[model samples]
Target: MTSPAPAPETVAHDDLCPICHLLLYAPVRTECNHLLCASCMAQWADASTLTRITPSSLDMDLSAFDPNYDPTPDLEAGCPMCRTLTAAVPDRKLAGFLEARYPAAYAERRVEEETARGSRVGEDGVQGMMILIGNRHRAERGGDEGPNKHNWTFFVRVSRPDIVKEIRVNLHPTFRPPRVVLTEPPFEVRCLGWGTFTIEAELVLNEPYGWVKDGMGSRSQSLELSWMLDFEGRGKQGRVRAKVKKLDGDADHPIDVDARASPVNLPHMDHQHV
Candidate 1:
């Protein structure tokens, strides 16, 4: 019998943040192509006294505008290392990649983070909200091009949108600025990749709503979740209906239909303009 192949892993050898001088955790990418831990970047940006338009951390949803919206610019602080604009987004993709290549070390980093953040959420038995994971991949040239070289879009849906104050997506570190926070509806993230990877997120509830009782009658404000991206699954795989015609030369796409076997674009995508 032949043995199965091992999973792919892209490791970063001692990828440390310039500010913290520690392994990048929930890292973010600066415009100058520099990597820094998300918390470190946040602190740096916060320390900035720039009177410019600081981007809001809360991802916005222009519901009426639907699929088109402007992305806020990066913060106006000089990077601690390069003195470039501190503008950065969570480099969850890199985090994902690092986690894959250094599972034990990455796990230790996660534990450190959790510890600094008050350890685990109270195990009140309450799950907080349900997380639905989905994905859609488009071949290079309508399946005639390159199938192995396609983009992978990973996203999530919240069970209780009303109570969800914010949805923070922790993408596989393989993606730049792998962490994303959505303050509006249709919480999701898009990244270009060839294969599937893990996805994680947490739903931060509005104070009182955050506290809840579970079936076993316990209370906690934790709604952390993890899921694998399924390219061959059915889970409403698109934000707005995407057409191959507008995409490439296939014009006769089904009018305004979601879940086509093609690529998709939606508004408010973390670090994604289209």
Candidate 2:
């Protein structure tokens, strides 16, 4: 008999794009820290400018008129809701997170995106998604001693965290236990360091994403990654500009995208990501 279906992935509403109201596909983080799909933002720039709104109850008196009351969103300016008017960068790490957490949904979006953009992936499954390591640090006034005096919390923002059985982080060799194992959502490791160093991690996959070979999947899978830390300052944070690598050498089984997480939306269903 066939095996039971893998457990469905879970994610917060925040992970959903405001425009499409679906898990973000190719997320682009605006300067204002709002995340929306690149495609959706492009459409907004092309047509959905937050132009002046007609106030149903405006005081049309001379005293009510303010000198600086501009409401129209700048053309291709900024986020539609906030109107910050700045550049939006592609968030590769988040995209990877989506793939690992929402395989079916991500695949569907990938196909839809490719079709819309007239692009295509190799016959093989979607490019394997890699484990992306993310972190944030703050200046630590009281540290042992060294130029790298900060307390940084390294974290992985993968969705469907349950699929990850455990996250093993390999720290500097000098530490008593160079390898640290974490078993929980928002897998994070807070550490005090005095020097910038490279960190390696291995994530063991569980049901739904584990132990698959050469394509397709069974339910037990794992991925390994390494990211070098740059304690420059001001939490500028390292970029996800690292070399591209496939996740676990294969994507989740090629499940029909339409089978889950319906991505369809109707006009007037404004579910902005506030």
CA lDDT, every prediction?
0.48, 0.51
Question: What TM-score does structure 1 among the candidates reach?
Answer: 0.36
**Model 1 lDDT, full chain set:** 0.48
Root-mean-square deviation per candidate: 22.2, 21.4
lDDT of 2: 0.51
Per-residue CA lDDT of candidate 2, range 95-209, in tens? 9988888998888888877776422221221211223355566776754653435677666544334455677677777754566667776576777766667777666655334
On residues 180-204, what C-alpha lDDT tens digit does candidate 1 reach at each position?
6677776766655665666765555
Model 2 spans with C-alpha error above 4 angstroms: 1-132, 142-148, 211-220, 236-274
Instruction: Please give each candidate's TM-score.
Output: 0.36, 0.37
lDDT of 2 at 217: 28
Given candidate 2, what's the lDDT at residue 131? 30
